[model samples]
Target chain A: MTKKIPVLFSVGWNACINCGACVAICPQEAGFISPFDTIAVDRPCDIACMLCEAICPVTTITHELAPLKTN
Target chain B: MARYRPYFTLYLGSMDKQYDLVIVGSGPAGATVGRFAAQAGLKVLIIDKRQELGAPIQCSGAVSRHALEEVGITPNAEFIQEPIYGFGIYNQIGDCTTIDYRQLKGDEYGPEKGKKPLGYVVDRRRFDRYLMTMAERAGAIVWLKTEGLGYAATGNGHCDVQMRRFNEFLTIRTRILVGADGLQSQVGKWAGLRTHIKITELASCLQYVVDQVETEGLLEIITGHEWAPGGYAWVFPKGHGYAEIGLGVIPTMTQQNAQWHLKKFMEQSFFQKRFKNARILEIQGGGVPLASPLRVQFADNLILVGDAARHVNPITGGGIHTALSGGYIAASFLIDFLQEDRDASAKNMEGYQEQWLAALGNKMWKLHGIKTKIFHNQNIVERDQQLYATMSDYFSPHSEYKKI
Candidate 1:
């Protein structure tokens, strides 16, 4: 089993209004609305930098600590 | 040198067109001025960076009935969501004090007495579009997705405004320029207008449009450090089951950010249960100036209004009324000056500041004083308690609350 990070990004897709405010205010460019008009996070997320979480107008983007997997 | 020559040559001939007046930003302030100026037969052009009239909505969408009427706007079903007759103020510990407009003393309720609604929660997108439409109908040319990059005074009573329309670069000349852009206005800076508000005078806010919120026709305001340090949280009901729940905070007063405060507020004992069955429909955030208007709003051939001029109520963070009123005031002066063929210099435009001060500046200053005293009180609980205790005094006809 491969070791995975203990945290993951979760998006409440239904709550997103596709306002693009998150995209404009995010300092890391970590989050954006897809061409299909849905919220999407960039790959290899900058977990330490929480600017996306802080600036999200709707609190759509959040993080949850994952349980450690046993090998 | 040859490669750079073509681009430099292109810049030299970029001036595209000219207008009598150029207004930037299509919010209520800009649109209001555009409408009045166009109606007066002045060649006007209004531009906004947004593709749509109202995207990434920044306001809670609450406007007083009087404010709408003052701007010559009548509330109809298309935008008015709910009519609010009163409000409730709450503390961190779940203590609430309610104020009913009907029970208030004196002429504060206007001539309609108990019949009129105190305020209304509106669909901000539609409302902003309505204002823009009005401007367009009044003969103002509106350009969307147009951003003002910078400007230069041509020194001949006109300015050359550089702009970017989507992918194209362009410039428009205008005898007079108006900056109605919201907080963080670049126009104010480009015009060399001294309109800087201290960081402590700004409120960072975040709000959500939610469904399944059960409430009467009343606005809810929650205060205290736990709710929002140096500011307050609000729940403006938008008819049916939808409501706008948001809060603002002075950045320097709290280590935690507005997002943290909002999340904690949603999970609070009082609000957690209410929001459990609720669904958030949209999210919006922006900064508001909680200070007095700028001392100087006019420079040579330029004027700043609305949030760009810091014309927000420091205590309540309300700017729509002032913005609308300021737009009208600016138009009245601009129309007179232009019609008389007066030079659009700083001295000629000084009347705008004087007229605006006479209209709303004193009220804003008084509110700023009250806001300072309230935020300075160290004990949150005691402050709220004292506020609740004095809530009745606000209903008095002679009270300063009546002025607001």
Candidate 2:
């Protein structure tokens, strides 16, 4: 059986300004910013591109290539 | 002939003349890339079709402050007018809301004092010339009145470009080609890349730089079905008692000319009641691509930048800043390719795409999609009105209101 590539994702909490530009520009409809809820990254649909980082005026979004390791 | 010693080197590579890079257009994208690369000691050449610089300005000349810093250019105070604190967004029904990007806080938001301008409203002709001058100062050779007719692959990954400058057809051999030409770019089509922007996704625009108009400080955005179906009208203050008044309509919405509609809008009750008798000093018209974001930006030894690659932000129909950002990325990638001593192939260029996509492309895609749904929705007007109705009691007096 061919093994599937495990998806990886990370967003820096300190860097998120809740601009919603990411939510607006994600082609896959995967990025979202909500006033009442945390924006979650669904690995299967996430392309791991950080276009949100560039357009964000506040420099709030930073990405880590691999998912954070659980202690 | 005296003993021809097989003059050519490699399968198709020729070492006779080499340019570190060749950018097809002298617009924002090409100028930015040329400046950055030439500053780093790369042989860069930028070509433009127009005899004079900044002729026939296509854009509305709006860009964010953050975009300027990314390209290492500082904004002069004289260029800025109407310090945009926020956007006053009116819906199809004439009700409105405001989104304050300034409140978020950053260098882009201006100084922490009372209020500095969010960004400047510049004369594109002067601005484009300024950027081109910077590129020239950085050692990039600029050829004006030159048209890029076509390009041929020189066996290897390099290319032989055929261009006409001042009635002279010249062929240039370059290591890499950057397509910064705006929409209808022949460089993009010649590369076999899909640069075709559909009519439905295009905005036909006409703007008048009017003097003696009371534009005030606020950037006025008039929204309604009757005003502009798929696009909106803007009144941006250009300081010195003049304002840039314009309206854009989606191509499908109008078989009638854009300039004619603009004249009607000017005469209409909504605009003419106050700013009557405003003299129009200049009239400009052009196309703004609104296809959202493209899926790919590179192929073979070529890379596309600015409108040539469809990098315009869908929500605002603004691309100057984004294109400058793209220029920076393209220059960096070219430098890396040279350092690696590898011919710029798809694999090498893929890194450039990934870096940009990771930075701006994916978000542009999402934003464009959201803009499509919101702009095209039947209930958008009512929904926005309802949101505004509840705003009075929802927040403190000190807090700012956000409108989309």
Tens digit per residue, CA lDDT, model 1, B1-404: 54444564455333338999999988889999999999999999898877787666878888878888987888878888888777787777777777767566325542264467888888878888999999999999888878888888898889998888766798899999899876656687777676555556667688878898887777788877777876778888877778888898776677777778888888874878887777888777776667777888988889988887877877778888888888999888889889998888889889888898888887788778766676677787777665444433443334575534
For all candidates listed, what's the TM-score of chain B alone? 0.89, 0.84
Output the TM-score of candidate 2.
Answer: 0.73
Off by over 4 Å in 2: A1-71, B1-17, B77-85, B92-115, B378-404
Q: Where's the lowest-lDDT run of ten residues in candidate 2 chain B? A: B395-404
DockQ-based CAPRI category assigned to the predicted complex of candidate 1: incorrect
- CA shift of B177, model 1, Å: 0.3
lDDT of 1 by residue, A1-71 (tens): 55445344566777654544333333232113343223344333433344445444455777666545569
| lDDT of candidate model 1 versus the reference | 0.74
lDDT of each: 0.74, 0.65
- lDDT of model 2 at residue B347? 68
lDDT of 2 at B56: 60
Residue B55 lDDT, candidate 1, scale 0-100: 69
lDDT of 2 by residue, B251-326 (tens): 4565454555677677773667656877888766556666765566787778888877877877567888878988
